[model samples]
Target: METPGNEERRPPTVPEGIPLLDEEAKLPQNERPELLIITGMSGAGRSRTAAALEDLDWYVVDNLPPRMLAALARMMTPGEGGVHRLAAVVDVRSREFFAELVSVLDQLRLQGTDYRIVFLDADDDVLVRRYESVRRPHPLQGDGRLLDGITEERQLLAHLRRRADVLIDTTDLSVHDLARKVREVVAGESDRPLRLTVVSFGFKYGLPLDADHVVDVRFLTNPYWVSELRHLTGTDEPVRDYVLGQRGATEFADRYVDALAPVLDGYIDELKPFVTIAVGCTGGKHRSVAMAEAIAQRLRDRGQSVRTLHRDLGRE
Candidate 1:
């Protein structure tokens, strides 16, 4: 099958930065192996995305040549306690073998195999900065400038990018954000329920870039000001009581969770399994910690999956 970018013909525009799958993405339930092809620009967070999928219990193979994909897919056996979710990182690292990818993908579809392609991308400037920060040369750069390598790669990947089921733009995404995006794309593949992570952070330490929602608890009285609560963390009984005892603290927690009700429902409907809600205050040790716990508890009480992390707790 001829790819879209050949003969100077433009490919149909697909959705970008979201998991809007193509019509072909919906495979009939059968014995075919499930596969995810991870490809894109070298500095576009493919490695990190693969790591995140690994953490999600996916069987991840990094820098796999295009030819090996068929063999790997043949080995996958669904519901036999074997690797069912196979994620292969195929890219320019395969050199000339990479050009065989489009044909291989077409063959997979023709064979009725279930697979989806996720292409990661970033701005040229961001790609250049990433390579320079690591003091590494771009793979295709040879003796040319980094921009030359980026341009070469973009041209090489244009067709795949257009054909991808999910196109993630990592120009401004943090590692955690990228991981969350990965989760959003593959969440439906697993039986796990939606998981919410409530992070307690200090505003002074900077915002949590992966946060889906940020709540400020600075309006509450500072526990540090209270002589007895100064040395105790929010987990301590006295500190917890002190912070929640504030006039509007409990009300805020209840109302805030209520406000997030629709948003959480929307995430579940959209198959986004991971959510990070950050609670911030002057310092992470006191108000933020208490409020995060309160919010997490509310979520748990509603039978939603919840976990808590105190990011800046020990910083002070």
Candidate 2:
């Protein structure tokens, strides 16, 4: 569980600004490997995201000092930790250590080490609620309201957020939703089948900002109108039957699949790895969920790897 270079002998204080690499990094910069920086707001789900990456075979480092990133990269070896892919979960929790991020990024650039940053974010109100629910003070909150701490943290992270390679807004996402985003973004070519995520969401909660493909299924019948199925969700047999059994419901799935073939093909041909399809209805409770399931099954039948999520299944 030791992070790369974490327990190894080193100076008590790392030099400010530029990163210092060990002897292993002496080779020309062109030989460097891949690195993923997982950072962002304190309560925006960095822990869950990092855990998801670990499940996907990444060599995960928690709370690693930014200044030691280069050394850690250089120190990673297949025999020790199988660090072909390195993901470091860092945040503002380590105040001084985190301050060295900009300089460390510059060093990585100079070393030609490919790097991508996944920035996790959420709405202020949502963040406050999450903190309250957990009964934990915000990391930036010293002697003020939770909102004050959130505002301060947002200000601190504004710069890094702008530079993020992937920005995930978790304001309304479930843990599964966030995990799917993490998996899709980090999956290697070998795990390409998971390049697509099919999710069901309620338009009332707002569109899933992480979606690359937005499909509105509101045109379909509203199962909520039928009192008998109103309480049931898309996952339920009666609700699904009510939704898909409606006119043009099954047809829509068929035609949509045909229409998406060329688009999916183009993404694959262009080497674009991830796609999130958001299916929405008035309430994510019924119609959207069932259609999402049907569409996901169609894609699966075609041999594509896909995970279906109902973002507002019970929020109704």
Candidate 3:
């Protein structure tokens, strides 16, 4: 919670150290839209991060040039087509132009713009493995080995990494996990509408990080142990029907969503940005997925935007 009088506190306003075009100076603005300058290693989950930000209702621009930061920020100002929050992904994909990014951000500060930087990184081995799994070349890789390029890229980003307001180590984070962390950090800034992420996970792979709250449905039923249902997914009608047929399934769903409604409503009313509810069962393929889909549908029926993910569903 913000301390009393916190809303009045503003970063010291500075005159635009750089000359601005007359048209730029006259652009209508609102409470400066929260600007997230996203830049990081290739295969470190930049795309996922941007998508997550978009899910939070942020206006996201991918592969944006550093020189365009000021213009983009001005264009995204509130009442400018109803844009409020903005996120931009700037990376080595910009090539040599990327070298100018720091100076561009410095200029923004001199102009008293309010913004934050989120740098996503992963362990070298992890990133290498990810690249291998995807069979994709790193943006920085040339004719030489990819690891060499990754090393050089890391060295180049060392300073920005230090200056980042939020540093996410994606080594152990799934795309959903990375998104959840970003949501949490963004949500902390103000009371704002939040996107609820409903993720289903298997106890075998552990809990999902995106989950702000967890509900264990292992107590509901073990479709995996049922010989007839072993190979079917929770989305199958039989599995869902069987699970819903349990003594407390319908009642539990009702009571749980009912209990969560007001709390979630309050959070949204306060403008909290995102909430995650994780449902877990013995295996992510069955019960948890069913419940998550049902809950997602229920929330959507109540006019909530929800992203549902079933982690471990396809894992061997």
Candidate 4:
């Protein structure tokens, strides 16, 4: 029998999982931690996700038992160790302890702990490649083919998958993408760069796939109707002048930016890193492009570093 290096070093017993204690900390504290429970398909980038959280200044614990989450939380005092946030990375290596996770979550909820779960997922082929590249057998593989182990593990994790607060599919994601996704979800509360994306799109081309906020510029007068501006795009001086001079153009831009200020402030307060705003017009060639540029200038004036993407710019 040939054994791989990782298989030989891997531990057989899985630890019990639990959140931190509430009994010892009955008294109020100055700073309370926001707990994040990181669990997902093995080889699906759980380790990478944890590393991203750590880089964001979260107090992270790996391979913890479900029964100890409360006790562990009680031990940390906020100011003493810059731990306003905590994360626990757990897996299904231990069968008996894995079953206790649902109950542990119930306990945390009853105690009023604000916690969230982030589950990582990937395609079966991707999982297999990752496992084979590392030459490590699946944690649940007792005696079976590699795919058999993967199948069994997926079935085992089905319940948790349903309950996950955040699910990330890493099938086509790179390491940097994984990190960026995590940073976006958590808002890098510890301090990270803010990412602002303004997507200009055409209503006829459907909608931007990843837009968190959508702004419709189709209500504005269309430059396509005027024969003189018909051939010109929004970037052209004459088209820009025409679009901005429309009846409600400046009003819409000013009002939307004013309304967005509070939302952006909330994101910053909550420690979120990225938000995408999609601006759309009928054809995406003139009116939408002009309005997108206007909104982007406003965002930049607010000190936000903005990236403008014209999704249907050349399609017309």
Candidate 5:
């Protein structure tokens, strides 16, 4: 549906007098360095997938309109300051443009662009349950039943699912597991460094079993039991000092860091994809939050890109 004279409607061949024309110039012309198309069901973990790709040095574009795929892909190529690896998220959220993705992808293929489609999926029940638990409406739902939106999305995405080079069923996989799969698929022929994430959660909500490493801080003091500090988080100076002041807290943290430092350092040396360190406490508000922050800072001091998430912090 492009206009006959639109700028994006240029001839397939690179025009004459383009200075950067070369063998490498033949690569996909992208606006960002790498272009990724990320799309999936509302609860199917697209955000997590995008985050993982971002961690792996992929330039991630989230919730992109499907109509913009071809243009975005062109912009992500070499001459356009596009990085070589790009990931984008497209989904039901793009109500009108979503239908154009397949055609755009076809155009890319015809143009010999190097791209991959990753489809993240989960069982219907799991997705429904996730939506219910999060209290968030499905993207395709518009004054209709939630399941109707889910059904419509499934139908809409059927073609993409069939065409996906990688299909991940996240019903049982932890975020770490999903991230590992993403790393494996997208880490081809690249020398970029892997990024590590440490996610901390409360055991009350259940440990983040997807964590590559799980540390228990329940052995530390339960700030929830303290009337004065009950409402404060581990981010608070008093809570942090109080936790560190515990008899075995410092020792435990030191030994834990020592144990992990070598492993993480080795992972970097081997160029492994990514590692998630999960820390748990009785409640997400106090101990786990403190431990996660402490460990994140420690890793940062060691010169690593680290992200910390307190999964259960704001949950009821």
Candidate 6:
């Protein structure tokens, strides 16, 4: 009979037949249903993570109050309500309801309900940029500056960060990278391999936002000057050969990939999931695409996982 606003006034009373802490722990780990509590900094990719989990067939509830976790957990039973995987996006937006999270989590543990917490975080500068991009005020910002709210949130979440089963820092991660990390975590894949995305773009169209590294191929001879090559795209054999046959093209690709050896190794060592290498030219039709393909080939030859994206490839 406990209500959301009354959580601080009294602890939630578990319904009858719901196993208490001692009894719950005795059940095998696999026997217990899955409950994932998603929380963390406001702009730290919580929504994206939730969407990813949903794509993986998880039942996701957003902005759920912590006090309701036990009730939701009951529905997560395989037979009782048929929801095996449940992910709750809980955060400070619940206002006072969020204050009960710590006690509620402890209560769940004592009652024997097994759950895992994933905490997402990002650098302050990155968070600020995200907020500015979205034009949304931080939930705790009130009238203060964005940093003030972020600072307050960090202070409040410090304990939970330490308690989290998984802590993901999204400072350098793109949304796709975040999704891959979430999938890996859910699948219990401990050794995550680094995935690479090489994007071909035009300098005139601006740089790719998710690019971790950028290589300008405009230094090479412009194939656009060749009347026959101008009509063909990079995928055409003639354009590909012409572009890669430029004076410094092959040497540049070899040296750049060599230079990236340590950087790529460092990324893997640090457990970073994805790196985007953007190759750009004046128009993105010729040199950039060819170089991107060559770079991706070199990466694949070194046994790296790589995918190529041609942005602005047909814009001309």
User: TM-score, each model?
Assistant: 0.54, 0.50, 0.54, 0.51, 0.53, 0.52
Candidate 5's TM-score reads 0.53
**What lDDT score belongs to each candidate, Candidate 1 first?**
0.88, 0.83, 0.83, 0.83, 0.78, 0.89
Query: How much is 214 displaced in model 2, in angstroms?
Result: 40
Which is superior by TM-score, 2 or 4?
Answer: 4
Better of 2 and 6 by TM-score: 6
lDDT of 3 by residue, 138-163 (tens): 87788878898899899989999999
Name the candidate that leads on lDDT. 6
Clashing residue pair totals per candidate (backbone < 3 A): 0, 0, 6, 16, 24, 4
Clashes of 3: 6
Distance from true location, Cα of 242 in model 6, Å: 48
Runs with alpha carbons beyond 4 Å of true place in candidate 3: 1-31, 79-81, 189-316
Which segments of candidate 2 are over 4 A away from where they belong?
1-32, 77-81, 188-316
Cα distance off (Å), candidate 1, residue 196: 13
Task: Show pairs that collide, candidate 2.
Answer: none
Better of 4 and 6 by TM-score: 6
* 181-226: candidate 1 lDDT, tens digit per residue: 8887753533456789999999999999999999999999898998
Residue 184 of model 1: what lDDT?
A: 72
What TM-score does structure 6 among the candidates reach? 0.52
lDDT of 5 by residue, 124-162 (tens): 899989999989899888899889989999999999998
Segments in model 5 whose C-alpha atoms lie over 4 Å from true places: 1-34, 79-82, 188-316
